[model samples]
Target: MAKIWAKAPSPCIGVCKFRDEGRCLGCQMTKPEKKRFKRLKGKAERRPFFLMLRERLEARDRWNYWSRMYRRRCLKKGADCPLDKLEGAEREARAA
Candidate 1:
């Protein structure tokens, strides 16, 4: 039997229009990043990708929208939201 994934799925929130220098305004992921995300098979592999995406979103001041959207997506999918694990000041800082 395959291991069940407790983690969130792809960061994509169904908004695929690429903008901001090839980055998707929805998830801040580029086309290649989206493809790479698909090939990641486990939590270990996917966590780094999410962290990277978070950084990118922060850089673009997009975390407010993307984080809220992603949290909703994770809830709807019944998957564990990675953002829920954010710690202390890091979490608070990002919430800005």
Candidate 2:
């Protein structure tokens, strides 16, 4: 079975005491929509959850284009992304 946080109850404190710069420590979600981010960590499977995280963060980036939007998709899953496709996701935001 999955962990309790994965179950997605009232996990986030919403006070956002854990925000580093514009990201929340709970899910490392950005400031614009940290509240919108899932309180639970993402699932292991590659599906809508991952896509949603990508979309949400990308949306936030679009809203704040003047700021530095470093592509860091791997951080979402603790993996490595040398190509930084997630970094260039600004294009995705534009299309949206």
Candidate 3:
């Protein structure tokens, strides 16, 4: 069964750019975030990292920049939002 926070909210708006390779233009994550996503060890340990990445995204002053580019990416698909899927438990616990 899907856990309470089993999956994180996807940043994607139906714009997948990683279908060909382990790379994306929409949310430019490296091969790691692109491939081998389902095998993440734990959500508790991974949420902070994604949160950091999100903060990084929001902190950027550039309108169209690279860091801003992939900060959103960090994942290849929705229902599969890497940030949330990888770190949901940690995120939930953090708020508590």
Task: Pick the lDDT winner.
Answer: 1
* lDDT scores in order: 0.77, 0.40, 0.44
Q: In terms of TM-score, which candidate is strongest?
A: 1
Each candidate structure's TM-score, on Cα atoms with residue i matched to residue i, is: 0.78, 0.26, 0.36
Provide the lDDT at 96 for model 3: 100
* lDDT value, candidate 1, whole model: 0.77
lDDT of 2 by residue, 4-95 (tens): 22433222223345456666544445665544444435334322343555565455553232112222323444543322333355478888
- Model 1 clash count equals 0
The runs of at least 3 residues in candidate 2 whose Cα sits more than 4 Å from the true structure, single-residue gaps closed, are 1-44, 62-96
Q: Please give, for residues 4-87, the per-residue lDDT of candidate 3 as tens digits.
A: 124543333334566434534444444576344444434553455456545544454322453333345544423344533434
Clashes of each: 0, 1, 2
Of 1 and 3, the candidate ahead on TM-score is: 1
Per-residue alpha-carbon lDDT of model 1 for 1-96, expressed as tens digits? 112233457899889999789988789899999998878876567667777888898898989898899889988988767776544437789889
lDDT accuracy of residue 90 in candidate 1: 73
Sort by lDDT, top down from the best: 1, 3, 2
